[model samples]
Each structure stands twice: as C-alpha cells, then as structure tokens.
Target: MIDCGRAKRPGWSPSVHYAGTAIDLLVIQNLDEDHVEDLSELLRTVTVRSVFSNPTVTASALASMKPDGMRTGVSTAHNVLRDFGPGLIGRWPDTGEVQVVHFYCRFGTHFTETNDLSLATFFRWGNFTILFGGDLETAGWQMMLRNQEFQRLLVGTQVFVTSHHGRENGKCAELFQIMRPDIAVISDDAIQYGTQEKSTQWYRDKVKGIPVLGTENAYGIRDKRHVLTTRRDGTISIAVGAWGNYLVTPEKVQNELTLGEILGAFGRNALSKDSQVA
Candidate 1:
C-alpha cells in the first residue's frame, strides 16, 4: 500500500508485477530514471493507498530545481506521510510481526538522491527478520554502518535484499561483517541488468555465505530447512491487482529448513573436518 511501480521502461514494467496489473508500493529509492518514474498515473492506476521514502539530497536539489519537476514526487511523497495518519505503518508494539522503519535522518559524506538516501525497512517475526532495501547502495550502506542508531537497530538481521542488485560499486566487506545477515534475497530480473552469475557468486562466496535466493533461480528443495537455490523461471508466480500483487511464496526445500538450522550446518566444524573457501 505504498508507492506503486509502473512501466518505467520496456521488457520490465516493474518488479514482481505486470504493466497493468501489478501495483508496487513504490518506495522511491533513487531519482535515476531507472528507479524513479511517473507516480501520478501509477498511484492512481493501482489506486495505491500509501508510500514511504527517505528524504535525501535529491529532495534538496529538487527543491532548488524547477517547481514542475519536483511537484509530483514531493507532493505524492508528502501525502503518504500525512496519511500514515496517527498510527505507524508497523504492527502493534507487542505483536510478533514488526515492520520497523529505519530512516536516514542524517546526511552522509556523499549522500544524494533517494537512491543513496533510500529508506530501508525490516520485518521481524520471532528471530526471523527480512529486510527490504529501497535501493540503498555504498554511500547509504556506509552511512548506516557508521551510524550509532543504525548499528544498534541492525545488530542481527536474518536476511537482506542487497542494494542496487549487488552492483560492484557497494560491495564492501566491512558492511557484510557488520550486518552479517544469514541470507540475501536479490529480486532482480538479470536479463535487464546483465550477467548475474559472477556478481551472484561474489556475494555468495564472500558476503552472505548462507545462501542466496535470486528471482532468477526458481525451484524448491527442502533438506534440514536449508536454502536450496533453484531455477526460478516458471516456478515463481505473480498476481497484480488494484489492491496489491502477490508473488507465490518460494517453495520449501525438500528437507525442512530454518534460519537457525542453516546456521548450525555452517558451524566452524561441519560434517566434514572443516569448510573450504571457494
């Protein structure tokens, strides 16, 4: 019920959606035409009810630019806040389902655009936490890693959606060591981005180490509740509607798997004597 994504370019209409049917809660991550697109039609077409975005230098620069260019983005973004109404977008405090909002309230050394200033959110149910990054990259990640608030707020994240589709620009080893999420979910359609094998392997070997689920890999295998990368072509299903679009939940692996279970398998000592780096 946030910003809805629409046809920004050809081939891909938006993420997890079809051009006319899918409505994404467009949390504007950046102003780079790729990430930011016409919101008026999208919001009205999808009848999106709300939105959330990080107030970044993009806003500041837009403030300085022509009024016509900034009107829709600012006004639409503002409307979401005004209508977030008296209650927060998260669940009631005591509820196990928690959607905590993390903002870049302060500026970074080179923070610019909603992209670098993209708002990152997390959902925590029990010990399981899933992060949905609105495209935050190196500068943004750096800001987060250095901030005391961010550090305290992000001590233990179970999963992360890597920013900028795991672009080489922001793949900092330190960020990985700090956040240390057990899994990384990259909801990317690689055809548009280019070869994903190399980049995917880079993070799998060095950063996430746990397991990576790409929208590209589509299949399900369950063993001891561990993550199994599958070929994700027809297996993944998505539905678009005025209310919202739904993607079929990734199938459980052949063996039962859980975050903790996977972590256990990767202990200092495994079935074998020890683990070997790829």
Candidate 2:
C-alpha cells in the first residue's frame, strides 16, 4: 500500500487486518504525521522488505537529531530511484500477466512541507494505466513536468487520481494534458476542498469532457456517469483485464415495498385477470 491513514478515523485500521502479511514495498510518499500516521506501529507489526521515502530534509533531520549529535532513523528510508526504477516487478509466464510499477520522485531546492516531497507513481498492466499523483501540488507538478522523461512516462494514462484531494492548488493543466485520461478520481472528503466544479473543469478542458470523480459528492448530481462521489456510492472498485478491458462496480441501493404499493400491485393484477377471463 502507498499510504495508511491515521488511526483516528472511525473503524479503519490496516494493522488489524494487514499487519501479518508481507509488504514488498512500503513507499511512504510524505512522512508527515497525517500521511504516515501509525506507521511505526505498522512497521513493527508488518514484515516489510524495504521502505522508500524522499531524501530527509535538513530541517527534519536536524530537529530529529539527538542532543548527542547522532542521526537516527537513517536506515529506514531509501531513495526511490535507487530502490525501484522504471521496470517490471514480476510477470506470470503462462498468461503473460505483468506488473509495471514506476516511481518519479523529484524536488526543488527550498522545501517547506512534506507535500512538496511527495512521489509520483503509476501502475500499468496490459493496456490499462493508473497514475497516482501522491498529493503533489502546483510547484511539485511544475518541477516534474519540466523533465521530458516524466512527460513521456505519463502519456496514455487511463485513470488519474487527482493530486492533493482535488484542491485548486493541486490543479496542473499540463499534467492532465500529458495523461489524457478517460477518468480522474479525487480522494477528498465532501467540502473538505473547494467545489468539484473547478476540479472537473481542470481535466475536462484538457481531455475534452472527461469525468472527474470525487470521493465525496458535495455538489448535486451533474451527470450520473460523469460526476460521481463515494459518499453516496460507498466503496468503488475497478477490475482491469487484458486488452485494456476494465469493470467498475459502485455501491447499490436496495428497494423495499410499502404496504400501499403492495396492495396497489395486487389490485392491478386482479383487474388484468378479470379482463382476460371476460
């Protein structure tokens, strides 16, 4: 998993269910408490072969240094490029099922927050590609776009997880242009950020009427297929298969019949039977 939420959320904890399983690559995009809450507990419980994080900032390192002037926690983080580059992690020989996990971690000289240090990653197999922007904002995206290598990697992205929870500051028109995504997902709570209208426009303008799906539907329904939110739909899962075929399953609603409706149905049935008999 890329990131784990803080233990504060109601009825959600990875440690309870996933602690015993082996985690091949635990990539901590940003080590800020919010991004990495309960990570220490997670590391203690789970068997992680390796962990990848951005280079430790000078300020964070200095602040964390002990009074004896010994630097600790140095062994926990490995630079992304050194650890995992653009390549295939594994493949099934018979069916040719492949796993393509790529990492793009870049930062400018003068950093302030962990968000600036987020890593951009993507997973691809067959003809489907899903891009995870890792909470990257305007400045971080601008820096990444400057690199021609990054642009080449972003083309033909089928799905895009919007950066920084679909906030306006995270909007990078160039990134959307490069990805040309069919659908975009925003991982934000309802009204936690601004209106989805702005976020929708960001990608629609670039890809020509592309749908921007948010985790929360603060605004009313625009189009059932275009603008969808998880608040109403609950959990959304997408299954991708060969030749770029994929299926998305959204939450369903159950219908219950009232007594009046049941009686009305019986009356209509009786009338139909009488007409037939006559």
lDDT per model, in order?
A: 0.46, 0.54
Off by over 4 Å in 2: 7-10, 55-110, 195-197, 204-224, 227-232, 251-278
**What is the TM-score of each predicted model, taking all chains together?**
0.57, 0.66
What is candidate 2's lDDT per residue for 93-142, written digit by digit as tens? Answer: 22146454444443335455557667777777867777777777888888
Output the lDDT of residue 1, model 1: 31
TM-score (C-alpha) between model 2 and the true structure:
0.66
What is the overall TM-score of model 1 with all chains considered together?
Answer: 0.57
Give per-candidate clash totals: 22, 0
Off by over 4 Å in 1: 1-3, 6-26, 56-60, 63-96, 105-110, 191-196, 207-278
Worst 10 residues of 1 by lDDT: 238-247
